[model samples]
Target chain A: MSSQIFSPGLQQALDLVGIFVFALSGGLLAVRKNMDIFGICVLAEATALGGGVMRDLVIGATPVAAFSDLGYFSTPLAAGLVVFFLHPQVERINTAVQTLDAAGLGLFCVAGTIKAHDYGLGFVPSVALGMLTAAGGGVVRDLLALEPPALLRWDREIYAVPALVGSTVVAALIAGNRLTPLNAGAAALSAFAIRMLALRYGWRAPRAWHRNDSRTSEE
Target chain B: MSSQIFSPGLQQALDLVGIFVFALSGGLLAVRKNMDIFGICVLAEATALGGGVMRDLVIGATPVAAFSDLGYFSTPLAAGLVVFFLHPQVERINTAVQTLDAAGLGLFCVAGTIKAHDYGLGFVPSVALGMLTAAGGGVVRDLLALEPPALLRWDREIYAVPALVGSTVVAALIAGNRLTPLNAGAAALSAFAIRMLALRYGWRAPRAWHRNDSRTSEE
Candidate 1:
């Protein structure tokens, strides 16, 4: 039985590119947090692979692809090393990284959704896992850095929304028996475009209804 | 192919207890952070099952036991509800909760190690997964709360150490063909005692060689 939505070589190439960009974001965060070299590498690896690792585990893919593939392991370390030496230059090109991050988000969400479908997950949970696969690494990185998860923060530009949209699009195609490389590419690109637009526009999720509602309700 | 190390009945009970206590900790943190009811529930679930889910995914245990079991899904919600209503009283019993948390840590590490071994992970990674299983929930909790991971904080009591010791003990037994309920119980209890003692004594992990060393190294 065919186990993947895309050809193995194409998927591997997409996966590596996504891992590299996400790792850069993570490594930059570690630099901002003033962590040591080891900490930078840890954050990089976590950001690059944490979501995919999470998705694999939930779907029962044994040993995780990261654990099995030396490329998955080494890519993040390489990103971290680059960030360690040239964070100032990296910081100057922040827009480029955000755009790359958007592309990575697109690739991850579509890939995650397809993988979940292959594992027989239902629509809702599959979509959720797809977004998790796209966004979970940043959550892990932010947590390690003692910062609010950017995915959940209302102040941040819309992140998970694009991933969710891409996942939904793919899921809909799958349910309609129209899934194909062309459709998958369009779905991922849609997510990437939306995320890049959100970044460019400085879009934010709505905040709580009341500024103190969370605290007042408890009291 | 047997997938579990403990009897089904015993495992269910132990798992439930661990989930309940960990969920309580997560819920309390949410309340402290002034999160809404939904946030409390989210944190509770994350803290209770995050680690095991992570371990299961790594080992290719599909559907994660939590997703398959309604009880696992409901228990954490119940814990969150209780914390929501009785956070004041819950905070008053902080010491009791800490002790229970220690017990949960002990149970989780041993259980995680055995499960990893069952999944054919080598010794070192199995033990690491065991520690992750024991502490991953709290790390998730702290991250959700926008705080540093408790496990990584040098000022915090030595948390991973006890879990590591317990996992190592169990792994050693498994390797030596001496694993049994009695031996497992002893190993878990030994971990529990060590964690409890560390809590009571305010034990801390050693800080870096120099406070400015990390920053200086980068420059």
Candidate 2:
């Protein structure tokens, strides 16, 4: 895979946008948790960069872009500031925010797959990493705030599935050597559309087949 | 710091021991949660390797040791099997389990600092990484199981502080050019002792100063 498959500038701009959108979710969660500004910023940064940092680390990308680039570091802080001043207003329009979040997830998963592949990861690992890059931030945010991650719960509306599909599509494109800007965009759009549909229709995953509750069995 | 601080064989042995102990905690938690054997194994692996993986990633260590080495991957599964069948006995001895956990924390923190420093991080970051190395797995475990991280809540017992101290001691020893194995052992022991004392005394952190409940304000 080429090291710079897409224009670096365009990719970076897309990354910053994804970071900003993810940061908003983190900041909103912090406000909901009644955390102060410092906690809000911390959560925002974690949410925005957690997955990318994790991906970079696994692939041995040194200094991790989160620390090496000032823009990556500051984008979350900007989101935090925005949330701090206008949470009520932001909270009121959560559906719009969630719609944007689906878009962010789509872009992140596709980008994550491409980058992981560029770093020499195999098809399976790249697809897995793409989903992680899309959902990892929310895991960090929920962990910090003591909320159960929606990604892991069977009862929650399907979230990670779309990200997985997006990543898998990107990986497939990479495998076929037919990866182009238009194809990549279509892959991301497909993922975004799936997420939006899941949201619209309230689709949810089922529990393990006949999952038995033995809560009382443990003393 | 030299690339190899201690004998590689000895360091690897110590790491396996720590991994096993951490895996025990993860497995036990899964049992308590009433998860199946597979859940036990998954949690065990996550808790055992999560911290070291995080440290390695930040330091640009490619192919992270946890995935590169078979022993690193398997020790946790061994722990999971032990917990799966013996949880009843293990839960009966919670205090002893916690003692082992403290010991594991001490060793991991020191090792984390040493490795991070060897990888060219400065004292402050090395110490910070050390603490993360000690606590990161527990955080991952709790997040996966939908529990609040004890490290974050002021109401919980002082767990991370001891790990921080252990890492700091290691960093100071490294900075002072006196990082013999004996001194490293002492650093680890000191951290272990502090954690044990905290547990024995039921020590807990205080809430924010003059913090008034403003929960109703949000609604």
Candidate 3:
């Protein structure tokens, strides 16, 4: 329950890194949608902080950290501005962005699980909250862009699965009284590796209904 | 700060009524979109409880009421099921549904303002949260349907204005030490009337730019 495992400075740094990468993703989506500068900023902020805000709210931490900390609020705006002028350059580094995004996902899932457990949630809810904290921002971003959420698409590279794996590992470690900063880092690294591997291998979750099954139903 | 202003029975009844109407709207949207039964239920639940859950989380009420109360969870599913089977009849009563939706918006806005105040938020945030409570579910519903949020569109019948008015009324009453159950009911009624009037009159809020304005920008 103690928030002392990761020092305040380390936590803040991790949070900022996650927020920055997520904001970049959101800004790219906004550009693809042909939205204006204001729209880009809005989406960027939502993608960066929406998940964390949701997590904080559910766990009774309010006046959310985003509102309390000026840096958290401005970081996304800065990201948006950076993308506004340098989108062409940013697009060239898509692979780099994806790598950083994987890191963000790993960090958010582990941190969210820890926060949920600290708030006294049970194991299952903690894991669910962790996934939400990792993937909820992208969901919000896609929704705003009027696209199906990438999280729910069976065809996409495994997204929530990695977050789930990391969260479960963190939860199991806590339950076994083996949780330490080193082990938590390892948990995040595992998620990062899983996500990167999935992308590299074009791994996807299975679809519920096969094309031939639907054709047979039609007949 | 006490949650006792509205009796538990009365609050529960009001909440159920609001949820049912919101869920019906969500179900109707799902039907229009040709989503399956599971999708209908998911959208219905999101439309009915998303706003309240958001408000509750931001105000530090953990484990949100929707998660704790079985009735809150089930009511939306019931509405979705009803709509799945009887959407033709439900669509026929579109006017009636809109009337009830206005009522839901009114009730939610007032209650949200009161709760935010109790949670020690400032006046502006309380009112903002109230508007979010009134309109947030519908926004989520539209986003899930891959449409622009109704609140942000200039063409819609002034949806958020009534909610803002009602929340402000309740907040001012509380600040004046004249808040009573009777007065709160009157506040909600005021919102309901305003919304209905706007619909009836085909009233629209003015947009900052016209279609020609964009053409002028090209010059």
Candidate 4:
């Protein structure tokens, strides 16, 4: 399995970091919603592992990594505990959290595309799955929290675009027989840079054409 | 594949019916949310097929039944179209829709359990997957539409209970070596009856132990 992507140690370590950051986001959302501890844990787990589980399921990987790997399961619980005890402090470190989140998004998109490619998918579908693997967890968190999905909302920064870029970069690397760790790191970095730039500048997707007219004409 | 549970014809026909019904509910929700035709189709597909895909993934089934079968892929689009053109007339027949929804729930729970069991899972996990199969789509629909999931809310008349009952009934039938079509039908009928009665009597799950006090204390 490690040979399919990164070495075992490298893959596991990065995955754990990504899962931890995503779980923190979910736990914070639960706090804002005034949910109980159980809700907080559930939301954290969903946000941390939901996207990976979704990709595994789509690719027919049984017992998904979230369930089979103990670290993956426990990291979110630990994150939830941290949030429950020290949310105000956690809230103050927003910049740090966003930085970690961008890294996670970049890693997930590149890794997800490679995995899907390994599973015999074409490049186009692999790139699509890569975006899903990055953004899906946030979507799951918002859905469970009864909030609009940030990826689909106009107010949010361009989330999917960064993932798409990272995935496309991976796909190009694979096609060119240049999928070394160094190149992959650069691809991930590009994604991270794009996301940070989007966040810094308040970049957002445009709403549909004739948005108000569509609603009014129907009424 | 047919031998996994129902006869091929019976399975296909019943599955199509369930997919169509679930899609109708999803499409109606998208329409209510004032989504465009594309959104309506996406919601319909997710609501109809999301649960089964989740189950298939957990159970290690690849190319899932939804993607493998053309009928499964197209039925939701057809339902979305129906809702788009005839929602007012469909809305008028609330009782009919409710009855179909109950039937779909019943069918899904039983079939999902048997499929999981056939995949070599224990009864406990199979039953859980069964409930996931039946109720998971609606959960997806609500989550995507940004509504509080009805199954998890106390105000809703016990959605998961019916699915649990149906799956448990199937599990018991399997244990007793009486899992024929007739027995499975009876099991489904029991779930349908419970749901219809629950709707009539307004049964609800209890809230957490502390409830408002828990929140107030924290605040």
On DockQ, the candidate that comes out on top is 1
lDDT of 4 by residue, B115-209 (tens): 88888888899899999999999998888887677888877899899999999999988878888888888888888888888888999988777
The stretch of ten residues in a row with the least summed lDDT in candidate 2 chain B is: B208-217
Model 4 misplaced regions, further than 4 Å = A175-177, A213-219, B2-45, B58-60, B63-139, B148-219
> TM-score for every candidate vs. truth?
0.62, 0.62, 0.61, 0.61
Per-residue lDDT, model 4, residue B127, is 93
Give the number of colliding residue pairs in candidate 1.
1
lDDT scores in order: 0.85, 0.83, 0.84, 0.83
- Considering the two chains of model 1, state its CAPRI-style docking category: incorrect
lDDT of 2 at B138: 87
What DockQ, on C-alphas, does every prediction get?
0.16, 0.15, 0.13, 0.14
> What is the per-residue lDDT of model 3 for residues B179-209, given as tens digits with 9 covering 90 to 100?
8988998989999999999999987888665
What's model 2's lDDT at A129?
90
Taking all chains together, the TM-score of candidate 3 against the true structure is 0.61
Candidate 4 chain B minimal-lDDT segment of 10 residues:
B210-219
Off by over 4 Å in 3: A2-53, A61-114, A121-128, A141-146, A152-219, B30-46, B53-93, B121-128, B144-146, B206-219
Residue A51 lDDT in candidate 2: 90
Give the per-residue lDDT of model 3 (tens digit) for A20-124. Answer: 999999999999999999999999999999998888777777787788989999999999998999999998999999999999999999988888888887676
CA lDDT, candidate 2, residue A62: 75
- Judged by lDDT, which candidate is best? 1
The predicted structure with the larger DockQ, 2 or 3, is: 2
